[model samples]
Target: MLRSRDDKKTQRQKSEVWPMAKAHVYQRDHINTDEIIPARYLNTDKEAELAKHCMEDLDAGFVKKAKAGDVIVAGDDFGCGSSREHAVWAIRGAKVQTVIARSFARIFYRNAINCGFYLIESADAVDKIKDGDEIEIDYDAGVIKDETSKTKIQFMPLPDFALEIIRDGGLLDHIMKTSA
Candidate 1:
């Protein structure tokens, strides 16, 4: 749900608000996992170091200030590269909770879920959403609201099963819970 600017102001004025510290806007399609976290970093077994280089080209300073629960808004084909699970691992390792994009590479999408990363797709949502926009995503409602723009964007809702898996931390955890 993308909210209008006025709506965002209203929301902020009402109470405590968390604003995005950084925003990365990409113009191209098919930004693969390599771009998100370069292959060279893969040599290191530690995710902490690997995530430090994530999206180095896109945002060199991201690793320094990015917290565990930051949100990433990207354009079409956001994760279109290799089938490396390390890519997903690095993102999760960085502690990013959600990724909103126009479209995603099939493998990347599934890999993200398997690693407990929430991925949402919204065609024009990325365009309308700017960097640092105080936004709220309602996973159950399939909406992304931009408090700054006061714009609301609708996205495809995650299937209940998928949500369940994510809610449980990942497929492995989900399986363990059900098996028990």
Candidate 2:
């Protein structure tokens, strides 16, 4: 028996999984992009440089505390204000695997995904998760499990096309591949 092409694709997609990570809880609402990366760092689009200043204004120790594969959990409007992609770069550069929030500003959400950053909207998870909590997110399944609280939260799943773009490491890469 031969497997269908779609079935084969599903197997490959399942292999592309995000790792479990620790959570960095920031409970403030309306955390604008300006506060996330700051305008001072916007002079350079270099992710590495921008990452050094990520969340420095809102949480002075964030840069120092953030580790590779850590997740950011925040309250509503986590990414509001200016449509700067710098904020997205900074967060991704910091090696934050996922950002879970109650809500997000439209611009920031698009910029984040375009930059290959994963952002999840889960109000329940935001309210329950605390700093240093262990979290495992299955992006394909749209599920977030908090080990610390033993709670499971679900988010709206992105369409297959959106997931493909993210899997290709952002829109640019996806476009490049498809265009070629």
Candidate 3:
């Protein structure tokens, strides 16, 4: 189980398995969602097109090489810029199941969960993860393990309500399911 300290640490416990596609290392600060998905692609309102241009600034060919179920490990203050839900959409569209970062922008973190995008915070956890490393995220156990390195890290788990939202595929889906 991965254990971490973040604002949402008082949540529930669960575990999930997420495969890695491409890992982006953030060596800088103030990297916002715009840099992750860019505002230019927002015009189309299509996640596929938006995903095609994801992380263009940081990694030019990232979207092209990404596969489904990929998880991203990033540095501090990730998704820090504008509260564009499209950023979360693009990542989800690109098949990125989860994102683990040292820290997340408040709005971005909320938006991600609302969109069923799993976002985790762990500064030290991100340091131990490398590109192409297979990671097992045990939400209930609050543990993260790097299969390749045989290393384990800890992070705080999400709340029960948040976990339910994600399990049902975002807020919209959850609402629709319950409303029926």
Q: Give the TM-score of each candidate.
A: 0.78, 0.84, 0.79
Number of the top-ranking candidate, with lDDT as the measure: 2
Q: What is the per-residue lDDT of model 1 for residues 19-94, given as tens digits with 9 covering 90 to 100?
A: 5423344656777887888877777646666667877766778767677456777878888888887676666566
**Candidate 3's residue-wise lDDT over 1-180, tens digit each?**
222222121122123455433455555566788788877777776766777887777778778767766677887788888888877767766767578888888888999887666678888778888877777777667777778788889888788898788777778778998899
lDDT of each: 0.68, 0.77, 0.72
State each candidate's clash count.
19, 0, 17
- Model 2 whole-model lDDT (C-alpha atoms): 0.77
When summed lDDT is taken over every stretch of 10 residues in candidate 1, the lowest stretch is 3-12
Q: Model 2: clashing residue pairs?
A: none
| lDDT score at residue 92, model 2, on the 0-100 scale | 70
Task: Please report the candidate that would top TM-score against the real structure.
Answer: 2
